[model samples]
Target chain A: MLPDPQAGGQTGSLEHIALLRPLSAEQRAAVARQCRWRRFASDEQIIDHWADTQDVAFIVEGRVRVLSHSAGGREISFTDIDAGELVGEMSALDGRPRSASVVALGEGALLAFLPARPFRDLVSGHPELGLAVMLRLCDKLRGATDRIMDLSTLGANNRVHAELLRLARRGRRQGAAAIIAPIPVHSDIAARVSTTRETVARVMSDLTRDGLLQRRADALVVCDLQELERLVAEVRGAP
Target chain B: MLPDPQAGGQTGSLEHIALLRPLSAEQRAAVARQCRWRRFASDEQIIDHWADTQDVAFIVEGRVRVLSHSAGGREISFTDIDAGELVGEMSALDGRPRSASVVALGEGALLAFLPARPFRDLVSGHPELGLAVMLRLCDKLRGATDRIMDLSTLGANNRVHAELLRLARRGRRQGAAAIIAPIPVHSDIAARVSTTRETVARVMSDLTRDGLLQRRADALVVCDLQELERLVAEVRGAP
Candidate 1:
């Protein structure tokens, strides 16, 4: 059975989390005790569109897609949330309904925490925590703004290349070759890049032929960072 | 002569403005004291791109265009700020150099306020004030995101029509006919919609010929909003 939600023990350490680094042991304990781990199968709905849920979750494992739908049920993707990123934060902060839906891309685990009132009270007691969360929100906003600009201004090929570069950077660390194993499906790439699946497939084929990337089992591995960066720069009109 | 930046006294009232209604008298006075009124000639630069100014300004009169430049110095416009709209709030929040340049479309007047530290301090002291600003920011983010989706997903003509409907809503109130005068130049619309000028012009002409809009001296007067909304629904695949 799952542990009691009201248990007062040190639930887990929060120090290892990048955003929670400044919290004290006691505060970390408070946060960990409040958090509940939940699992979802592939394609499970973690949050429904327009639902009012004050709980904020951190992805502990696997991936999820954030998306919106039209009245006629056409889907438009916003972003993909990877492990270690916070989800449903803006809704929790503003007490608003979810603006988009979140669905697990595969079997995933999330550390969900609820009742923003307690969280706000904790932040009030600890101003540093509030500031840290605000800074994280600002960083997310900056990224969303850049993605909007990219989608609006860049062409399909450049957008795909940039997305590959970003995924590589996120999947690998400094001095280690970035690996984006088991290439994302063409339709998934199209959704993220706001292009058609055929266009994405064409671009991928071209990139493979140019020797900038290699095809793995259901994945495309980026083999040449220099070439990818060069293509991006050329598209962006960089020197 | 311009008023002294440090001089504190009575100033113009912003209570009549729709967007400023949430602000209290004390808050208005606090903001007004830090404000300096500036006048600009036609085609003058109101805010330079990449400048380090941290002041947020309000347009008391006339109009301003927010535009960005690529690394190669190619300019793309985002939107226009008309009378009574807040300008430059994003820069104030981010503390970064201006993301885009603002230019006066005609002779105009703006109330520039200084020392964002004090304004932010005021917000921190008054959570309600901060909430109001946050709501406005959220609204702007939603609009920008929607525009990005439109540019990527909609055809050129559909984008032009959607833009017209957006402008009509902003320029008109409920139960009132929208008398949108001085429609933006076709070239400007092209930039904002992320399409070619010729395409924008062709679409606008077609819209006028279809009786959806009537061309005026300086604007395109929207005649039938219901029809335009229907077109938008059809294009966006709504029920």
Candidate 2:
């Protein structure tokens, strides 16, 4: 596919994908030849949970969220995969059905689909690529474990504080503060941390009132990251 | 290490370990030469949380529980790894400190320790072995995701029900029934599903009174597996 100048110059090239960066130019070219390209509009369903598809998607542009819905119709958002990252490899490796649904986020997104067989072969044939995939899974497992610990041990307020700290770290840093522009929606944070929207709102207001958080035009600032971290660690123990 | 015929004939051979089973016999033997063996008494610590060591442990005999304690001194047991499985690989792969403490569960436990460097070399050098480990990690990530969904959507009572369904499936089968012999401790179940001992006790009693669960001389029998599954699925929706 030709590079889309309008779509931030996304060429669907294997070179830009984090999982394939270690490959030589020729190796990457071979992999790119095996991959098919697709573009998704914002909020479009890129991969449905239990769809039985085994193709792995490498994000070439924009972000996608991995999420699932409860029987009660509540959505549980797992995590976001950004450009240069890949998704759908678990099923590719294990020959299992899709474990969760993935949806493109914001504006438009570009993805390269590599069918399961070729993906597995590529990983097995390349030592560095295999290790890279292993490292990515390691990071995902660690993130999941941390969420489990928080869900098992912490209260709602503390969980909210943890989520804010996480978002702040991903946001812009000021002089001794971190600003989360267009601050994350309360309900979204609630879904991630397994809390209620009201609880998240209450926690946010309390933090703002206590001067631990600040609300500016289009941004929410974490005034004291260390204090917020201490509040979580108090109950979370030494980890 | 010699075959401890008394210790269930565990020879600490790589042949018996699931992760390395995909490797060639010669490859396994070569990898075995680089491993060291260790044994731990019941309730003894195997890997302490935050420890800097990075040796991956393959469980050859007995079982161990991976756990951590909250600042309140409440223990949160993550999962139990049985013989033929492995643990401590996260730190081995990422060079990070141990994520959680692992404790031996029975009279004695035998483990084969492969240092971080050799373990990484073993995985990256062997394609089949690497794929096997990736599959194992995929299972773990799916499990963690399921736990996250349950925690985020289900309440304490429902969580307990879900946990019981999980245990029942792992228990011994008796025709259409399932028997969890010596039934899990209420407090331990409490830690696992993030509930209180009282809540677990109350739920058990409720299930027993309703005839959905029965207490036998040495086991907790799920009288109707389908019904128990239904109860959980009522809130859990579909898999």
Top model number, lDDT: 2
In model 1, pairs of residues that clash are A182-A219, A183-A219, A183-A220, B182-B218, B182-B219, B183-B218, B183-B219
Candidate 2: stretches off by over 4 Å: A1-11, B1-12, B24-26
Best by DockQ: 2
| Poorest stretch of ten by lDDT in candidate 2 chain B | B2-11
Cα lDDT tens digits, model 2, A1-239, are 54753465333477889888878998888877787778889999999896889999989889999989989777778899898899999998988988899999998688888899999998999888898899999999989988988888888889899899899888888777899988789988987887778999999999999999998889999998778778877877885
lDDT of residue A173 for candidate 1: 37
- Can you give the TM-score per candidate against the true fold? 0.77, 0.94
Taking the candidates in order, what DockQ does each have?
A: 0.29, 0.79
lDDT of 1 by residue, A54-102 (tens): 7777666668888776544546687887776667766666676676789
